[model samples]
Target: MTIHFSCTQCGKCCHNLRLPLSLDEAADWIRRGGDIELFCEAIPWPVEPPQSDAQAAHKRRLSFAAMCGAVPIRVIVTVVAAFDGACPHLLHDGRCGAYGQRPRVCRIYPAEVNPFIHLTPASKACPPDAWTTDKPVFFANGQTLDSETSELISQSRAVAAQDAQLKERLCAYLDVHHMALANEGFAIHKRAPDVMLAALERLKHDRKQVAHGAAATWRFVSNRLSTVDTLVSIGADTAEVSSLPNALVSYIAFFPSDV
Candidate 1:
């Protein structure tokens, strides 16, 4: 089925959202007095994903290579401005206060960052009227009708890859190193505006050191002990979140899958 979408200016999309941001946008987020959270997840990468496959290519493009104990892995990082209620810039009239200066993600609204993911209107925050026939066809024949959105998505993927290593090191610098398994969930690391800004700033200038000095170690955190045990059996270092009373890390389990 074809998908038609147009912003009815219902402003639902702007409310109670966690917008992903680039590293630069993350810095700007703090300047706006808003908080940013880092979400990190990793997938085992014993062998390089095939460049010919769309999902593999896309995943490799957005992740950085690193070792998990003795296991090699590719880690993906997401920096988000996690705000509740209405967006800080959402005007009373439903206009974006800083529309012109909105983040690239805002410009790519209602679309997914993952190529394999399909857009489901019912799953979106947009209202039913926003998907009426009168709206422009957003997706058809497995393609997005909007070329600019496609371009922005590509750019976002490239930039995420560019910042992948730095973002990982940023976590290391802040002592936020536990990661959830990819496709399962994310290890949420919320940082205060000042702390995150300081870490980013300090890490920015120490890029060379962070990238080349020493390989900072990382551990896996899981809600399922069986999952962690599975990783441990495979020689991957693991951290039990239950044992850490004061660790900044928290796990968001997507499914309680049996290991």
Candidate 2:
């Protein structure tokens, strides 16, 4: 089936947004006085997911591998420009203030970076009329038909892989080691502006120094004690969900069945 989309300038997508950004874009965001939110989740490795190799490859492309105690895992860190109300660059005239220099994610709007996630207009915040426009063809035959959108998506994935390792190290400096299980939800860590910018600066300038070296281990946290016990018994490091009740970090789950 073909999908057609044209933004109605309603700006719903721009409000209460946590737009994903590249490492450099993240630094630029903070420099422009925007906040950085690290949304982290982990996938158990060699405990091996039920997915096919192709599905696994997609996950690997977007995640950095790390160890959670004796259990191996892959970590995905989504560096987001977490803003509320409206994007700082969204103009009152319903235009983008930083249009030319906007992040790739901004340009790839209404399209997903993950190939597995098919674009569904009803699932989006856009008004119904946005998809009723007669001219633009966004997707067709279950694939993105817009060459520019396709290219941007490719670049987004490539940059994600390129930034993976460094992002993992950045997390260490910020003391962000806890993660929600893959597909369960993300443990959101909101960093102080000074601390985050400093880490990103260090990431920009230094590449060799490791954080925690071979000693750093990530732990999973779940709301249900039974899920915590299940992971712990399997040698996956874990922590109580209630242990963190502060401004810096929190967990948001997609489903209550994490237990």
Where is model 2 more than 4 Å wrong at Cα? 47-52, 208-215, 256-259
Please provide TM-scores, in order, for all candidate models, with all chains considered together.
Answer: 0.89, 0.90
Worst 10 residues of 2 by lDDT: 207-216
* Tens digits of lDDT, candidate 1, 225-250: 78789889988988766644354667
Alpha-carbon deviation at 33 in model 1, angstroms: 1.1
Question: lDDT tens digits, residues 101-163, model 2?
Answer: 888988888888888899998878888888874949888888888899999998998888888
User: What is the C-alpha local distance difference test score of each model?
Assistant: 0.81, 0.84
Deviation in angstroms for 246 in model 2?
5.1
Please list all clashing residue pairs in model 1, or write none if there are none.
none
Q: Which candidate number maximizes lDDT?
A: 2
Cα RMSD to the true fold for all candidates: 2.4, 2.6
